[model samples]
Target: MTTVRIPAGWPATEEQARAVQDELRERVVTDEPGPPPRTGQVTGVDVAYDDERDVVVAAAVVLDAADLTVVAEATAVGTVSFPYVPGLLAFREIPTVLAALDALPCRPGLVVCDGYGLAHPRRFGLASHLGVLTGLPTIGVAKNPFTFTYDDPGIPRGSVSPLRADADEVGRALRTREGVKPVFVSVGHRVTLDNACAHALALTPEYRLPETTRRADALCRRALREATA
Candidate 1:
């Protein structure tokens, strides 16, 4: 795997966040109707933090895109080099995610992350950051919205609401399973908004979260647990 360089000195500050957002928006594809994806295999990425150490423990879980079953897993450990800024979380985890993805024996068709995407204040969340760095089709599915606003989908699972920023549609807040909280779905890169939702929905199997995310979350916890043990 090729090493993707992280742009040094990214503003972890609010001013920097805005600047980077503009840069990212200009760099990212916002054109209508992206090209059809020809590849397969969807991967889920999740992070478990060691609060005391301020370290990021993460996992990447690859699944059969058609069947949504786990096929491979990779783990990574790294420091949160960036601060916990509201819209700049991609800086905190992109390196660790790249490390973990690099360790995977096989490449993935799509990557779904536990964060926001085009719905971000700067439109460059973790998903977009990693997607741009890796040139991968990625989606951001967050349990909660960051700065974007929309009507709640309510308690019923499978309900959805549009995530709008500045009175424009950025993404969707989807309820995957009943009674569980909804997740915000947004396009990261090289993927359409509808395709992002399709990938997320296809990975669900009687769970509030996608199969990939569930697997990665469990893997992340296991990594943290084993490392601490």
Candidate 2:
């Protein structure tokens, strides 16, 4: 595990954080179709928090895109960089996540975040922030569409509906399993929305959540427990 420290000049208030978001949001690339699904290494990044202890633990698990096999994993623990805030939650998580990713032994080809990207109120979420910082092809596979509206998809695997913000389509609600609730997918950076959803499906061959997410989520939670214990 890597240890993390809050970067100097990190956003100290909601206004500062939002200002940072506004500036970085403009840099998020949405034109390119990222790496083809299931072709290269794909990594899942997730964080666990112990608010009472002011500790955050982040995990990055790299998987072989073709077979969903784990290739490398790293964890980082740090003081929570920011206070609890809704849309700005990424600020609290990003520092340790970057540290975890930096500690990884292998290159993380396409990163999958267990949070939002373009499907955000500010149109810049964890995945987008991380992508812009690392210049990686990244996507978000979220369990819930935060404040967004989407029609229920068909009761079959691979079904999808547009995740909308008013009239503009921001992301997708993708059904990875028959009769299952859809996972929200969004373009983070250097990836198209369609390709992002395709990668989400490719990562979910066995579960409603992507294997990358499932594995990283478990690892981060465990790391948090160990750190706190």
Candidate 3:
């Protein structure tokens, strides 16, 4: 596990964080199709927090896209860098997540964040922020739709419905398993919305959540427990 420290100029107020987002959001690439699904490696990133202890733990797990086998994993623990703020949660987690990704032994081809991307109210979420910083193809596979509205997808696996913010189709509600609740997917950077949903389905061959997310979530929680112990 790596230990992380908040950068010297890290934002301390919501205004400052929003200003940073405003600047970075313009750099997020949307035209690129990114890597094809089921090729190269895909990584999942998640963070666990111990608010009372002011500790955050982040985990990154890379899997072979073809078979979903784990290729590499890394964890990082850091001080909570920012207070909880709606739509700005990425600021609290990104430092530790970047550290965990940096500690990984293999290249993370496509990063999947257990959060939002273009589906965000600001249209820039954790996945999008990470992608812009690393210049990696990334996507978000979220458990909930946040504030977005979407019609329920069909009962069958692989069905999808547009996740809408007013009139704009920001993402998709993708059914990964028959009769299971769908996962919300959105383009982060260097990937299209369609390909993002395709990759979500490919990673979720056996469950409602992708193997990459399941693994990283568990690892981050474990790392948090160890850090607080």
**Prediction RMSDs, each to the true structure:** 3.3, 0.7, 0.7
Name the TM-score of candidate 1: 0.86
Error of 2 at 2 (Å): 1.0
Model 3 lDDT tens row, 83-106 = 888799889999999999999998
Q: Between candidates 1 and 2, which one is better according to lDDT?
A: 2
lDDT of 2 by residue, 1-229 (tens): 7899999999999999999999998888999999999898999999999999999999999999999999999999999999979899889999999999999998999999999998999999989999999999999999998899999999999999999999999999999999999999998999999999999999998899999999999999999999999
Q: What is the C-alpha lDDT of each candidate?
A: 0.77, 0.95, 0.94
Model 1, residue 167: displacement in angstroms? Answer: 0.8
Task: Look at candidate 3 and give me any clashing residue pairs.
Answer: none
Least accurate stretch of 10 residues (summed lDDT) in model 2? 83-92
Give the clashing residue pairs of candidate 1, or none: none
Candidate 3 weakest ten by summed lDDT: 220-229
lDDT of 2 at 115: 90
TM-score of each: 0.86, 0.99, 0.98
Off by over 4 Å in 1: 1-21, 30-39, 153-158
Q: Please report how far candidate 1 places residue 156 from its true position, in Å.
A: 6.7
